[model samples]
Target: MSFQEISPADTAESLRNGNAVLIDVREPHEYGAERIHGALLYPMSTFDPRALPIDSSRDVILHCGSAKRSGMALMRCAEAGVPINKHLAGGIMLWKREGLPTIKVDPATGRVFDPQQG
Candidate 1:
């Protein structure tokens, strides 16, 4: 794999320290439902490596419901000659499993809540 995988703990730390930014590769509905607090949405259905907001200041990490889509996104980046090579290993499922925080929106109330609280 040309890409490197980052664990939820490490990803969280990186984000907390402002050393990295997350890119969500899931669809719009999935992103609207729940996601890492600061993750920027860029659905795989319309993902374009050329249009990614990569910069030299911070590393960009990609993620989806699972690592599959993010892995595919990495491949796309590689094919397009984009150098982004990190993803949240095992995705949000693992992130939640690791007890990390996520922003969840209630479909009925449109209210956001902490999954750990509900």
Candidate 2:
């Protein structure tokens, strides 16, 4: 199964408009360090395609720190009979490079921190 790759900016916009669901396939620690705001945690290490929210009306976009992990997740999903075809082209690294916003999660308290506020 092939997947569609979207730009970070486009993905952000789609997410803001509720046109898509962003799934982050990175590890928990990586998610805590930095992640696209509003992305759902679905780490590849413990990924369960069946556990993913199924909403045919909404588009699902998977991503990781880079496209590598997300790509792997896509394959896994396909193998499991889960049809996920969209992903952030370059992942969070590209998202950051595109000047998009991300929230840093406080591991201890699970609080979200503003990336611009240091």
Candidate 3:
């Protein structure tokens, strides 16, 4: 089954409008390092598409550091008969390249990173 892919900017817009749910399929450490604000953690290593909450009212968008894992997650969903709304075309890398806002947490100190200070 074919799946839909959305651009990072469009995904960000959908998220801002509360019309989509962004699921990050990367590992916890990766997520903690940097991630799109408000994205839900669903690591691909231990992901169960069947366990994903189904909300007909909103779109479900899956993503990872790159598109590889997210693409695999989409296949898993399809195999499980779960209907995914869409996925980020190029994942978080693309999102960051687009200059979309993200939340960065320091794993050691649990402090938030200031983008401007970087």
Candidate 4:
């Protein structure tokens, strides 16, 4: 099944308005290195569409390093009868390119900092 793509800017707007839940489908290590500030980790390696916290209150948007994994997850959701069908286009790469806020761990300090600020 086809899925709808939400741009990083628009995704940020929805998140600011509390209208969307961002789910990162990348692996744990990948997420630990850097990620969207409020994105929740739900690695596609162990993804279970049925387990997703889906509700009418918020739109669940999936994303990954480049959108490949999220698209795959969306297809999995479709097969499992889950209604989540939106994702962040171009994934975190594009989000970063667009100068959005991201929480990144500084290897030397192991502290989280906004990459956009650097």
Candidate 5:
């Protein structure tokens, strides 16, 4: 079975509840530049569920620069037995657009982005 898709807020909430997995499909370089708090590195182009931490019973959420790639990855992972409960609607760009928390990765020093509070 395939996984369910939801908004970034729901996904983030799932993560906060400690019951979901967040997989960023972007490459290491891109991921290093910016990523969600608990998201892991699993580029869809090169990831094989049989190799990574994928388990059919667990919740898995895939993401990319845009929802396009993540959607594709979600389908593929679902076909590969990634569990029907897993959630994946899109990428982090939209999540940021929603005003959710995000970390910007710096290429030079590899620092995370944090706009200080006023």
Candidate 6:
């Protein structure tokens, strides 16, 4: 089943307020290249329910490069009794498309950079 979506504005607000947990379901390599400032890494192939710091009662947002993987993860998380809270409506790409903040992690020296600059 498709999961509920939270708007970019709402997501940004929740994130700024430290009330939202952003779960990124992208590959480790891909994530190392670039991602949001603070997102939880949870590879779809190896999602451990117990590893999550989220409680089903709280706000937990999931995402992928686009929206496909996150959608799948959301269904699986719900099926596995992880949580039923809010998730990214259209993934990070959408969030970026909406001009949201995204951080690029340097693979060479492991440094983080702001995407807005370059």
Q: Pick the candidate with the highest lDDT.
A: 1
lDDT string for model 2 (57-117, tens) is: 8899999987999888888889999989788998999998998989887778878788656
Q: Write the per-residue lDDT of candidate 6 for residues 58-112, one digit (tens) a residue.
A: 5888888777887777777778886644578778888889988888877778787
Off by over 4 Å in 4: 115-118
Which residue runs of candidate 5 sit more than 4 Å off their true CA positions?
Answer: 1-3, 55-58, 84-87, 108-110, 114-118
RMSD (Å) of each candidate, 1 decimal? 2.3, 2.8, 2.6, 2.0, 3.2, 3.0
Error of 3 at 66 (Å): 1.2
Candidate 4 per-residue lDDT over residues 10-108, each given as its tens digit: 999999999999999999999999999889999988999999989799999999989999999999999999999999999999998998888888878
Q: CA lDDT, every prediction?
A: 0.94, 0.88, 0.89, 0.93, 0.72, 0.79
Candidate 5, residues 29-117: lDDT per residue as tens digits? 88877778888888866977655565555566777877777777667766777543444565687888888877786778866576532
Residue 71 in candidate 2, Cα distance off native in Å:
0.2
The weakest ten consecutive residues by lDDT in model 4 span 109-118
TM-score of each: 0.94, 0.88, 0.90, 0.93, 0.78, 0.82
If the candidates were sorted by their lDDT against the true structure, best first, what order would they fall in? 1, 4, 3, 2, 6, 5
lDDT of 3 by residue, 16-113 (tens): 89999999999998988898888899998899998886799989999998798999999999988899847899899989888887888877898997
State the TM-score for model 6: 0.82
Q: Which runs of model 3 end up more than 4 angstroms from their true locations?
A: 107-109, 114-118
